[model samples]
Target: MPNNIKFVKESKSKFLTTKEYHGYGQILKISDDGIEKHIVVKPKDPVFGITIKFLETGHPQFSIPDVSIDETAIMLKNLEEAKTFCREFYERRDEFVQDAI
Candidate 1:
């Protein structure tokens, strides 16, 4: 995770944003059920690699990999592409989410 990065909700939007650090990205909450699902992006390395994750909340951590969920990533090459895709993804969330999951 990037240091000092915090998520703040965008005005009239369902997603969150963090300032550019190594890379920039968005956080989209996709579920409100028992185990909330959140889609977030973060840098994979020294600022270039971008990784998107489909996160499940309210679940107890396991010692080993026991369970799994479907469709957990939105892979991108660099910060620029990640930034562009974040915009596009936010604009077409419904379409992208359907394909993503």
Candidate 2:
């Protein structure tokens, strides 16, 4: 199993007019019952926070404080859904990273 994965984000602050950025991340885990779990660390703003919210199906969703800059929000129904979302997010993130590099 993979040990750790780190995702980074870099951007220029409009107010500061300088490159300012940060990262959002989570910790992966396999439970004793052989269930995959994600222990989210620094969640994205306005979507995910420190607390973990689980549903009846054992799925999880988190919320960030005020980062979206819009009324729209992000959510996940299950681990698979979360994975799909992360895949898309990373795909876009990679594009941005490549452009930055």
Error of 1 at 58 (Å): 23
Collision pairs in model 2: 46-64, 46-65, 47-63, 47-64, 48-63, 48-64
What overall lDDT, based on C-alpha atoms, would model 2 receive against the true structure? 0.34
lDDT of 2 by residue, 1-101 (tens): 22124334433433221112222333322112123222222334334433334421335454434445353343333233345444443445433333333
User: For model 1, what is the error of residue 61's alpha carbon versus the real structure, in angstroms, after optimal superposition?
Assistant: 26
Per-residue lDDT over 1-101 for candidate 1, one digit per residue giving the tens place of the 0 to 100 score:
22322323332224432222222443334432223334545444433345554323322121111222331232332435555545555555554345333
Off by over 4 Å in 2: 1-25, 33-52, 55-58, 68-101
- Record all residue pairs in model 1 with backbone atoms less than 3 Å apart, i.e. clashing: none
Model 2 lDDT at residue 84 = 46
| CA lDDT, every model vs. true structure | 0.37, 0.34
Q: Please estimate how well model 1 matches the true structure, expressed as its whole-model Cα lDDT.
A: 0.37
Alpha-carbon RMSD, each predicted model? 14.3, 13.8
Worst 10 residues of 2 by lDDT: 29-38
